[model samples]
Target: MNELLKVNYDSDRITLSARELHEFLGVKTKYKDWFPRMCEYGFSENVDYRLVAQKRATNNPKNPYTEFNDHEITLDMAKEIAMIQRSEKGKQIRQYFLELERKWNSPEAVMNRALEYSRKQVQALLQTNEKLELENKIKDQQLNELKPKADYYDQILQSKSLVLISQIAKDYGYGAPTMNKKLHELGVQYKQGGQWLLYSKYQNKGYTHSRTINITRSDGRSDVRMQTEWTQKGRLFLYELLRKNGILPIIEQN
Candidate 1:
């Protein structure tokens, strides 16, 4: 806890630098020679301690960098090495390590660790909620952009009123007479004595409705005639028929 020998807490278990431990214990032998001998006393390689390669500047300038090996031994192994030294410094280090092990496993330390874990979980959940909210906002914007088209299509389907030929023709960028000529050319209608009528093939198809109208000419005489108007179904039929011929309404073209 007071930085006695720079212990490593990066791993799940506490580990000590074996070279540092040797120096602190005042071993007579050099680290390269002393560490191997310490391993000989029933200490396994990776289970008790692991080797770490490090680089440093050398005294000789010609070979400026040199690589050396150090070991990270567990607390249990360090304690064992300290006891084997049979010195006052070794006893003191061993006592310090024992205290560290006790505090590290205490209930207070465990509770602190649990609270830290819960804090991290809550932070992660908050970030996820922000992301979901952003996604929903984008989806709502997309639906809003499509709403006008949906409303227009619904109006077209629900209309029950009859439309004049001129009105349908205007939608297709055509005047009434031009539209009639085109329809006659397409074999859908024919010009009779006083009016345009659907061809025999298209007659009685519920595409048109005849309304009787009384007209007064410039001669002060009145006349009765049947005026043909297109129903919604007939308008839709003309839309499809004209669309196949590469014709489209102004609204559709826009």
Candidate 2:
């Protein structure tokens, strides 16, 4: 491993010793001559390379007691140096360094993978929500299908001699004003002489039924007033008449 490359981890970035890189590149020339020539290629200091220097004794015997500067360069600077060298070894070293870089795991790659995983999770959740919404819609349709039978049980099974005009309108899901409008279209006028009366043609058909009630006020004045009402059969007759003329009861929709 030392012969090929000596690798180090610093803050998750891969670094190589400058002396080891020079030796591995097998440059026969002095490092001082090679280093300055590579720097002239415009590689910025501290970005492509970080130099670590210390004072060292000179090689001269008389100057052995004195000191000189020694330094190191980074892997980027080494790659640039390898590219410039005109030798088969330099080409081999450059290829090997590229392979190392390709194999390295980066923080950006990890973050991108995490984002992709989150997107998949969100897509799955949306699909599930759409499925649930469709299921709920099906349930609502089924409930609507059962509504007419429930209305029949209330209107027919619970038989009564008479049902108020207001109750009949409610069962058909009509307000008083809308019901009056429909009745008017059928030639039946309401609350005249306090009685629901039909026009000439419908009068003989007996589509309407009413009764009279006598009431005495506190002043001792008694009066006979006709109260408007509908029987079960009368209610059915009106329902059919209005429906045939393109006016349908709400239950018919279900």
Winning candidate number (TM-score):
1
TM-score of each: 0.47, 0.35
Model 2: number of backbone collisions: 0
Score each candidate by Cα lDDT: 0.86, 0.69
**TM-score between model 2 and native:** 0.35
Q: Name the TM-score of candidate 1.
A: 0.47
- lDDT string for model 1 (9-86, tens) is 665678989988988988989999999999999999999999999889989989989999999999999999999998
Winning model by lDDT: 1
Stretches > 4 Å off in candidate 1: 59-62, 117-254
Candidate 2 local lDDT, 125-209, one digit each (tens): 9999999999999998887876774675466447767766677677678876678777876777645754667676656554456
Residue-level lDDT for 114 in candidate 2: 68
